[model samples]
Target: MRAGHCAPGWNVTSMKDIEHPIPVRIAYVGGGSLNWAPTLMADLAHDTRLDAEVRLYDLDPAAAERNARMGGRYAEVSNGTPARYRAVPSPREALEGADVVVVSILPGRFDDMAQDIGIPARYGIPQAVGDTVGPGGFVRAMRAIPMLAEIARAIGEHAPNAWVCNLTNPMSVLTGALHAAFPGIRAWGECHEVTKIRRQVAGIANADAGSDRWSFRDVEVNVLGINHFTFVDAISLGGRDMLPAYRAFAAANASGVNETVPGEDAEHDRYFGSKCLVKFDLYDRFGIPGAAGDRHLAEFLPVGDYLADPGRWGFGLTPVEYRTRDQARRRARAEALAAGEIAPVAKRSDEALIDQIVALAGGGTFVSNVNLPNRGQLAGIPEGAIVETNALFSGLGITPLVAGHLPEGLHDIIADHAARQSALLQAVMAGEGGALFPLFHEDPLVRHMPETEARRMFGEMIAATSAWLPENLKGAA
Candidate 1:
């Protein structure tokens, strides 16, 4: 990796230094998560600065137990990074006395997610990724909001002083739910869409300098807007402006990415793939960098703009069937790993979870783009509405940095979603769907359709995912 690409202004020592490795308890709400939970296990095993005891809890007790065993094995083989793992029977038991609570859960099964996308597509409305916005996102929020609220309530009762890091979808709504249900909860939503920009910038920095790879940590960005619809106005590396280089990169890749972006491999591109065609397109059109991946960004804009024909833009809607297949494949792999049929690998994730934890636990200061209630950090969004913007994480607490108002058009675009997300959070919090129809009817993706058709589509989407939804919402439209 290129020099100076490591953590910027990183303190070599913190309250808990190398020798001490302060002990902390992390309550993982979705401990059975095939993807994120393992990543966290590896991260904890790879870090020697803090001792982490992770309690895994999931609806599938057996899956959680499997992960617990895998985590124990992972820690044992990591040259001893100081950690422990266990599977808890309930959310409260897992959360009690925890120093940090991680919430990363699937609201329902893969089939449920399929319905989230399929029903909308039946209306000739295509969504590249349904977990964030569009009709699929709203339906997801319907269940996820209540589920997260329940988690938040448990945290309030069991780990009142713990820091919460949410990694669920419909990010804005879910994160807002935490605050809405328990206003005193210390929580923020973590998403990696903005990190993609930093990684791209790192690649550009490396290529421009004619050196080895540069760590994404070297790049600093100014983020604005909501989770899936975030934007980066400025990027800097080593006290040098990198936007010009980024602008050039965007221009070159605007039509199609002719080369592999830094760490990407063509063979592995399907499960997580994007040439950032949407990002480049946004830069070309709006004079701003779209921070989220093409699939996610497509859902936020007018449906016809990208989702209508995503393939034409060099990104295709990842079929739900593919995710289902991938999950099954991953499940098998996880079983093998947990059964000790294969060696458990320990590699730190590029995500900022560990760093954020360290920073929050009196480790040091770090900055990253995260979903938090707007506190004047984003200009056009209302205070207390969840918005994604850069924030400083340190011992004192999370402090959102100023992300000035966007151009009127951009501001209005982002503000519209922010308002909708906040409104949805309220509706879900109160367990009421009175405003659901209006919110669905007004979404950028649904607004273009005739009112009657939009209402029909909305009702069908709601009914498709109604099993977990509250009684008042099963027939919302």
Candidate 2:
């Protein structure tokens, strides 16, 4: 992290030798994204170790070029090392000789996302974040899978050996789609939800036990289940068990109302904020800690808990109108940064993208939680279904650690999601959109509704989002 230091890795010396310098090429899909692109551009500017040439590809060439200009501004403004950034027109051109590919894209317009949430709301379903689960996530997956598969095919044709790290929501299904389209592709999905949990656990343990030299990075866990619904069975710090302290903390806070998190500002208009009230509530029920935020966890549970009236709970539901307005705000910010009218932020994200890439490049072995095919890493989840677990990343290849099983109380809820994701994947790949009703009807929010009403809502949702859906999927129900 220091100036002039090589990126943190093992067994590498003089990675930045001026003579005969080794080049690291990274392909960034969805490079036009204002949400993630700026974060990556800033993170890359400070990472002196991997001075990569990042070629960006996006559906909108103009947005991508704007981001490229922002990256150039980073190089001009920073006193530290900065990665080179450029915009390319096609996926193949961006990925032709890349060492790693990062994916974070919006599947459809914000208008389509509005339908994804609004139609479900009319049917009495509650969703805190619609893109991860509920009826919204199911339909969103239908639109996202095929597009992700096309990107997968390009990676196969161009950079077959590249390691892929998908950051898209509906992450499990889309990561599976990548492998399904290209069986030989090395792909995994990364999320920071678990990182949030680890930080919370470290704080609680330190307060209770007066722990010896512990930080979020020192907290070790055995991760299980899939993305957004992930759980941790065991946690330790400095080889000492911290579950007892966590149990006491959960017991005290499980039955209370939380309006603000410990470190976040309460006065700001927060679209994504939580105080872990829902996570503690789940812990009280299943005796296992939920790793994702309360808002994301609420969507996977029964409607009454967190979503029926979201504002009454700690985490409020993010409205579509707010998101629509925020797009223009983000665009304005992007324009200012791109034009050098404002200085770009240089702080790095806590995300694991750069660490994963460095490890995959034979820099060293790095272990972290990754969403991969279930090859016995998670028991009871079907094989080849994308599941999140601890894995070792090294020059040898990705080797998933055996993460045991889901608790019996949570077995049905987690396993059924895995099954539904598989069914959705098959339906999308075959373009059999009408075949999805059975799974759609059985989703948690829809199962309790009258059969006729559920079907009607399903049809209306399809009709509403048809602008971005393919012909085969448009109102096929």
Candidate 3:
């Protein structure tokens, strides 16, 4: 609602727009996605520039229908000429001749994710957000790769020219699999982990961090490493290096001591959580500012009981209860919207997917963290292995910036995982399900435990998830 925020269908006329309104067809692969679909719908409703159509497809018909209704309702209410939204039953129907394809699907059920987190915990290898790295990350890739390959093939046949912007978990691996599956597809993984960190940095420097409500355009940064495990190697504000100031703040807050006013404890303090004490610890050790939150960074840290009690690393476990609560909240929201008690609220969001699409279509430029093949952007990682780094998106294509080299200490950790990630992708694509076990053998957490125990736990997890595992992996054990 605020001025300067990208409005639904931003009508600003560029040379391209002046010539004729571009017809954009976006296919939402997981159109029933409870979290991401709605926000994207709202963004589309706010934009006034393009003549757009959004086709929603999902495994759950009712979920997709709900989103289609909500999306259409938002467009009707926003009073802006928004993208027409419709629910379709199949990927082929959704993806046919689309200009941009947004993939954000959960390959399996929520129960499977619970098993991913819980099975690892039984062995004392704790994971906070297990979708990205560690045993959970590898196993998740096993389940997700096949589904993604299917989507890639669908796109190749139906929307071959559409730009694929994946917002899925195990981002690097999933996105990498899509690239490998369809070598000619233009695809990249989009994540908000690094974006949130950028906002936090802006707050620390007293600089403007752009928001959906308020636009604060200029913020420059340099990033490196794989997803979940990334770092802000350089940050500048108005041509001034802000790293020293940011580091100074981190150093001062290293102890994470709370100074509360009489009777008011830290738990009652709303602003206490902003200081990332664990990341600062990493800064001291690795000499670069950590990009992700402590919860994600905890998975890769070489410390004891850090996974079991993430509190040991200054964070808490992401229990299954959290997901239960989230599901309940989503159901309630859906019900309320259906009953007309709540109308869709239209506002700009910080997500960069739509912005990237608009930029690519309108000949504008968009810069954000994108996951793609390394290709010398990171000297430490393999050339074609997926790596998350800063890049510029334009009509021509996404050009990853030269991030040079990661620090040797950090490089050693990322390189090890990157190699394993490559092996996991190869194994899954080749249907060599048994080969996945050795990749687990090299896992940092599994490496800490006894080999026999680790193998047993790994096999147990594989067996537990057999229902959803690809045909190749289903009977491997």
lDDT of 3 by residue, 180-203 (tens): 899889999987666545665556
Structural similarity to truth (TM-score) of each candidate: 0.95, 0.91, 0.89
- The TM-score of predicted model 3 comes to 0.89
Model 3 residue 396 CA deviation (Å) reads 0.3
Number of backbone clashes in candidate 3: 11
lDDT, residue 454, candidate 2: 87
* Candidate 2, run of 10 with poorest lDDT: 1-10
Whose TM-score is greatest here?
1
Model 3 score (lDDT) = 0.75
Which pairs of residues have clashing backbones in candidate 1?
none
> Which portions of model 3 show Cα errors greater than 4 Å?
1-21, 207-217, 257-275, 303-305
Itemize residue pairs with steric clashes in candidate 2. Answer: 7-49
- lDDT (10s digit) by residue, model 2, range 1-477: 111111232112223333322368989999998888887777777665566788989999999999999889887755355678899999988999998898889999888888889988887896877997789998899889889999999999999998898999899999999999999999999888888677877777677668644557667777888889888888776557778877787777755434343443543236677767788878878889888888888888778767887665677777888887777888999999999899986666767676567666666666678899999889998899999988877767787878888888787899998898888898888888778888888877778888889889989988877776788888567
Q: Rate the local accuracy (lDDT) of all candidates.
A: 0.82, 0.80, 0.75
TM-score of 1: 0.95
Ranking by TM-score: 1, 2, 3
